[model samples]
Target: MPSKSSARLAALTVAAVCSAASAVALTSPAHADSVRIHDIQGSTRISSYAGQKVTDVAGIVTGVRTYGSSRGFWIQDPNPDDNPATSEGIFVFTSSTPKVAVGDSVTVTGTVSEYVPGGASSGNQSVTEITKPTVTTVSTGNAVPAPTVIDAKSVPARYAPAGDTAASGSINGLTLQPSTYALDYYESLEGMNVQVADARVVTATDPYSELWVTVKAHEHRTPSGGTLYGSYDSQNTGRLQIQSLGATADFPKANVGDMLTGTTAGPLDFNQFGGYTLVANQLGTLKSGGLQRETTKKQSRGELAVATYNVENLDPSDKTFDAHAAAIVNNLQSPDIVSLEEIQDNNGATDDGTVAADVTVNKLIDAIVAAGGPKYDWRSINPVNDQDGGEPGGNIRQVFLFNPERVSFVDRAGGDSTTAVGVTKVHGKAQLTASPGRIDPADDAWKSSRKPLAGEFVFRGRTVFVIANHLNSKGGDQGLTAQYQPPVRSSETQRHAQATLVNAFVKSILDVQKNADVIALGDMNDFEFSDTAKILEGHGELWSAIKSLPKSERYTYDYQGNQQVLDQILISPSIRRSCKFEYDSVHVNSEFNDQISDHDPQVLRFRP
Candidate 1:
């Protein structure tokens, strides 16, 4: 489960900027024709004359960001330059609120430097800036530069530059090729006045006062016209970030499949937040898609309903418990068995010796019961104090909540947080030697991650194996908003290993009984079209049930205006062969602004 605090922290990490040098006082006034803004901002990602002192760099102050440590005003050249590759605007890092007005024609004398937001360790591109600026007002009430129109024809078809490797790792290492790639196209326009006309919203508006839009018709548009967040192989080339430089109330609220009508014109500013964003003074009108909250149909009697949900760090102190319980009851229709993730300890985020989540789970169960749902029995093995990675002191782990009236748990001895589960044959049937046990807790792949909870259950005299997993999240991975070409998913390496381990365990059960009804599901933290999912569904040993949905409607998570799949239910060969199973990604959360969790729970109803 991705926490909003963590997401905001990541945004802050990207937004982090280097300390500015001492400000130089405006001692001398020079001619405005001495240096052009385009000359200062060359055709490359970095300034050609970086570290060199340039005098009398003249432009009209277009915008100002006075809030953060990197308080500065953006200046753009009013005169037109014939070279399409060279940007006419640049950011003057003043460190404090600039004294210049927005329409004031300013002449700045400063040293050009390439400042990397988030520092160099972040691997993000450097933003060309004029540091230690000495500002002089050339003229007042000057007209700003006309924004360059960015439409379908202006944006390149290729989204990113192909460096030495197939995927562009970092644009900072390679030279800029604006004509060839869309990233370079935007990079070339960095800090320049730009406009996106009639942009189609791809991602929903996030808490960061930003939204992603595509100027052109994308190839992977969803049924509702939102862009599908495909694999790393498919890039949304024309996608641009629309950032509001005004108050939060001014930022438009939009969902996937919505449109930004009229033209959004602003300066193209590069930062670690969302790569190249148009810092618009005013946003376009949000055209409603009329997308409403969705509910899954109730399960029939005798049908076993299993679901996987990442409750987003459920704790006794959190207020979202009732909402989550209502979602599980009314939206997921009170699944017979639910594989829950991120169940925090009794003390919640307290660093006390307590590692039990009994109180937390009980509160959710109580809420579910109050919501008119059946009383559910729960089971979970608390991880060693802070061994599993999540919010500090939270001690989050996987848990199971099952309706005892509908299904029965087969608990046996030797089940604990540290012991690994073993399988055996009973009456020529596959059965866990220790039901409700951990799967390979000592395995290297499970290090600093949630160990899978494997539980054996009986429904209508038939046995089923369920594994609840919360794999390593994509926290350390490069974002889609990064400067890299296709972007790097460094977080997948551990998830791939984790999937392999889970697959091996699933194989052990299937090897004992070839038609074993096994389900491995939870917040995988990877996509259905990802390599992690591929490894889990190796050679048809397990079938990803999410793929069974229409390609456009398969996502359970909404990210960056793209509906993506991060939660999944993978079934064994017997379940796939039965063809009697039904799966639904109950869209009660994720899409809505008032979402209880960052993910939407998925329910699979089948007759075994």
Candidate 2:
């Protein structure tokens, strides 16, 4: 039906119709006026009775929305088959009556009348004597489910920081604010996981005051007042609060890199920063995994750092680090920890041209160790054995390289291997094939299972967590667009999964170390603004370090007619100190060697 004001216009239309009919009678019988309505369907029965009045019309209330404070509402049977869903059904001039909510099954009765085609009423053909008006409930409707409280740990591995949930890691600097507030929104959650992502928390004044925390979740009320919840967990949780207990027990004590987990009881209210109003309950402490023990000591005072690169299938025939090892060994651009992607391995055979063929991945490590320039080390390797590459066999590309000189490794694990990490449930293909997951290019089957690799690194002054990833390649035998689009081929789908796993892993890290300095680096296949990059940058917890640099140096990889910044070096805000981070696009790979690998090695230079 038309809105309340629209209904009044309908009345005016009827009056005009009557005037036109009177004029027609005075003129000639052949020139009489008439009203026309499109698709009367259920109202067709009344069309036959030409001038008869329709006191009551009935059908399901498919759509409804209240307008103008609480004046009146527009109700319609969105069903295409039912033609009685006209804009002029029964105009309820509810200037004094209560307003109506959407989805209310109502029976409206009024004096029926037709509107003249153009001279009088234009859209609707009705004038009813609103009687027997009543609204009932929809039948056989699905019940709304209760809101599912999510733990920070429940987020996917790709999103979590390295060693998130580990008991030993710590967050050093924490500054809270007072004049903070929350925002009200339901869709497109991009900055809800961490507090610093949206608003900066100034130093706390009362000392006992709780720091405002936010959560992300979707909330909706059904026709029957039943509430439905969706995964708004991305960036919607508004500002809530948490209190301090003792040394390591206080919430503020949680380092800049510590992850905190909780559920939203309702929308966040800034007034309740340190308390548990919007929060349903506290999950536990957020910690990057325990520190790893260093087998070697620090030789150079160079600032300990981690960097990611897309070596473009570093699987060379010569299979020795000596080819591009100079970039990794040279102190001017060498990184303490390096996260690499597209690293291919031999089929455990001695031929067929593989990078690890002559000198396995282990040999590269030995060479770096033998040279002993700055003295580096490594962590666990998921390797090609861990992937499902189908008939071709799982020649998996991975993330595993570190510096033992400045950092120590206490322990390591992969997949959703620990209680504090991993996904509890994975929606089946049917749930995602045609849904929102489809809009996302990364939503593929095989890729979801491959997962990302994470590790814990300890520096003398600070413990930095590292998350290394090499998401699915944007281009395959198919093309770049297919990397994230659906109807996903196994290969393309796996790459999408790689992107997803990385997103979840980072989210997990934020869960444990809200403000901890985390470094997420690898070959993400796409540009910095692509969906994959947006997922990590959505929450301000991590920023692409290169983005802070000059635009000319922003790019990390190049291709035919296109030069994109595919590889990324992201870091937590707190880590901005102790380092003036920069990426050197050393043309080593593209130099005289006719390309050391497909990708130019990105050199991250960080000086204390």
Candidate 3:
């Protein structure tokens, strides 16, 4: 069926920073810089031909997607020819396209390709063509700037660098790399601080911590048919792994493409991935004042604090805890307990040759040490080994984090890995009746499904059972049975099964303890109003963290222009009486320019 929708690859990108525009009113910049052609550096002005396409175009790459659904991407160069930085130039798109990602430099091109915003809709420019295409590397006059120590806040959280964005500082570019390219031009200038000018937002294929950008680099195919190159975007490339804490009182939201002028945490680690890669240390947002966050202060006996954050892709990957250890521990304000999904099996491997040889649970404990929070402790009732279930990184499941002083892990019950609750559990003879916007257990769709995790915890004098859930999603394999309908289906049978598992688990618990304080958190993977959600909350006494707010204010994740409540926190009848929840609207993957995980986190606050 030939759809009528325009099929042009539309890469979402922010505008270049200019004195004239506001944050939301972003416009594409123009590419119009003069090419002072020098013989590799001697400095000689090249003659400007009447219609020569060559120009010194520099800008943050706002968008990067395969051109025409092929294996190439267009680097939106906004600062070509220096014409107020509007959308201009085409840096070429090919299978051999350099590892240049979005949010980095779109420099080193010989000609230009321009997209006229909105041929149909005014102000929305689309790249129509590329006049010339050429590739370059550091060896070919593209001198990467020295590294520097910049705050995470200093870097633009969503905005790209404007042309002429000043360099905050400089570090050792060459010395930053423990190893370099054979040409000696250096791969990732580790331990060095360099400011890339006129940058723009790109995409983050990984989670929140990592970013992908575009820049001029030489790329070639290996004998195995894979292309090799390094990322040039500031967010992903030349990353300031470490930095001094920015204004200990405030942690600002990081902007996209902002130059991370910081030093490497250690020497570069290299393998087939690239010549070598370095980890950042002492990193902070480079912008003036970044996201404001305060450490937890001592509170009285009756004070209760709760929070929610999307700990992106909290897989069993060792890095889940390692990468954002500080954010989880310190920035998290030490919530009484954190409900997390995507906790992978300790012994899992990464597709990109990353991840240490450890399970996510154990590694998270270690990451707490790395992030300066040793007191944060965690556990999971669903004790699936790395290979327990057939997940990519072992059993990438959901678990919980607790402040040992505030909560303790007691035990687990209900469905095991082998005999997970499935469609049969949903049907059975218990209730043959199905209500409107309700899931019928008789549906064959949920015949096989992954059960939810129910972990018991004790806080103060009350017993709290926290169920960390990642319900069946809309996509994935059939045997996985992790399926759900998109956008509109309030009651998906498969999703209903997921809701059923949690319901059954809760029912079994209530049966044991009449007024058990139960808090179900993590990525439900379903919106608050969906049939699955209605079934979960149908019990009149239960409370949803987001239920207090209007529909617009309730969203833990965003997808395809629709904001849905996938990440949620549900409270049982007893807990909802005194403990009100505070759903912190932190940025999840998509809008925050992160691809860490598809779901966000939800926090619960209770007062004695």
Candidate 4:
């Protein structure tokens, strides 16, 4: 034997050389041709080679994601086969820092897999990928492939396929009909480079460096020249998501109705957030819409103004109290009686046994007085610990704040947090047995959700029954960018039930008194054209006050580039026949980046 140190070095060199030889041996194909990228990414939504080992997969590295948990690089074939439905590019999962460059040509050996983000409950589509890859570089400095153009001519006018049920819902089993539906068209261009030109902004730019756009001219436009969210039957086909690939500061800030000149070139990707996003490195110039904030004029004397506002999670610890008060005072014209929602308890998300909102409501009233507004008297019942469905530890409830000089509260006994209010005929008039009481609190529709608060108020010698409500939200529903065609709205079932209950209560009041001066208002968390609204308007029990305005000017909230109605005020037949009501949606929030609340309050001035 040789010396001790020399012998050890010789053994280590032998092991290293054997390791290099093993990698080449495992990756090299004996006599067969190399596997193409399209074969790995099949024509269907999922790959045919999933859960199988594949060798000699040749492609060029097109993109690299060096950060995050799912660190990987995307590879595309330099010469694509003649398969129109199959994609030529696929993602390789590394689970660490990526080791390849953008222009490197390589042959990879790995196991094919289908990765679903956030598990099965998310209802998101799975992405086909290669895991635990072994790479062998062949060349470098090659030219990238050209991007495919997507215009109005390329996309289909239809939205999705019919007869797809929620129990067995997927596009993987169906054939790709790119010329028939928008969802099919996007699936066909799944992992390819694409370009869009002369797009119109349909939604405002969000905080996540993303915006929605429509490539073609739209038929439905709002009064401000923005795109209107039509009914569910009319699907906006050419709509797409534009996501920035550069620094956050480099992205453009745009509002609805704005235009983007030139083209945006990027790779088409599907993720859990927004279904099909264009990850663009190059963006065009943004043309502004020149939209501005609006304020409503003050109400005339002797005209009682009733308003509804959703103060988003107001509490004592929050610092947005002054701004909200100013908006209510100046923008809303200091309404005589205001119904507020999302008012948290005194300790504000502390989770202790504190259920009183006196401190929270008092702070807002003090702020309003300092802003040169009149004194307001607030009334609300403290909720039991944490039954409401909202932020944890924050006991949120509905509250009413009124100008004591203009409107007087009609108080009665036997009203508590859990007691259900009963309706009765008093002197031939429908009246609440317990004023300011909860409506049907024991009903299944109100389980773990906000209960309707009913109050009787006397304004100018007329008694008006006001019911404050905040219904179930759209949290579990699919987004506008979901993979499924005509994305299913699963949250509507509960909202429909809630609407039925509210309709029954209204009918009870109208049965005793045909023309009861009823005004039901608050955050009804559904669209104006939704089924919930239809049930609320059944048999002409109440009319949506917002509908009295022109169609082009009937939105109280802005979300995802669509100005839609979420908060509404419904009036009785008597109120509608009068036609002496003036309605205004005070635009102090919902359009600007710096917003006090996510909603714009509504003020209805009528001589009751």
Residue lDDT tens for model 3, 1-608: 00011222131111111111211121333443554222111110011121235554343432333322223333332223332111132224343434655446555545332222222112121222223435342222232333322223333232121212131111111121112211112212211223332222222222213332222211221111111221112112222121111232232233333333332222221111111222222332343213222233423455444444445445553344554566566545556676665554434535332323235665666777677664656554443233222244444555556667666655433334433432212222111111101122223433332335555556676556566665666542111000111112323667776676567656655555556676666666666766667777766434577776544446555332233467777877776665444445344343343334444444556653
Residue-level error in angstroms, candidate 4, position 541 = 1.0
- By lDDT, highest first, what's the ranking? 1, 4, 3, 2
The residue-by-residue lDDT of candidate 4 on 459-535, one tens digit each, is 88888888898888876676664545456678788878988988888888899899888888888888778888888
Best by lDDT: 1
Worst 10 residues of 1 by lDDT: 22-31
Residue 462: error of model 4 in Å?
Answer: 1.1
Of 2 and 4, which scores higher on lDDT? Answer: 4
Which of candidates 1 and 3 reaches a greater lDDT? 1
TM-scores, in order shown?
Answer: 0.93, 0.41, 0.46, 0.88
Ranking, TM-score, top scorer first: 1, 4, 3, 2
Off by over 4 Å in 1: 6-16, 20-34, 165-169, 173-175, 481-483
lDDT for residue 383 in candidate 4, whole number 0-100 = 80
Candidate lDDT values, in order = 0.82, 0.36, 0.38, 0.75
TM-score of 2: 0.41
Candidate 3: count the clashes. 91
lDDT of 4 at 429: 87
Cα lDDT, model 1, residue 240: 82
Model 3, residue 255: distance off in Å is 4.8
Clashes of each: 2, 67, 91, 1
Residue 313 error for model 2, in Å?
4.1
Model 2 lDDT tens row, 1-608: 00012434344222212223421111212211222221221222122322333333443332221223212222333332322122222223233343343335454443223222222112111222122234334442322212223222222212111111232211001110111211111100100111222221111112232333323221121111111111112212232343321232344322111234322222111110111122112234443222121111223565665666555444434454664455566532456777665555655323343323223455666666666544555543433343423113324355456666666753633233212233222231111111101112223443333234566556765556666665555432221111111112234445554555555555555565554556677665556655556666656666677566554344444321123466677676666554566555443332111344545455454543
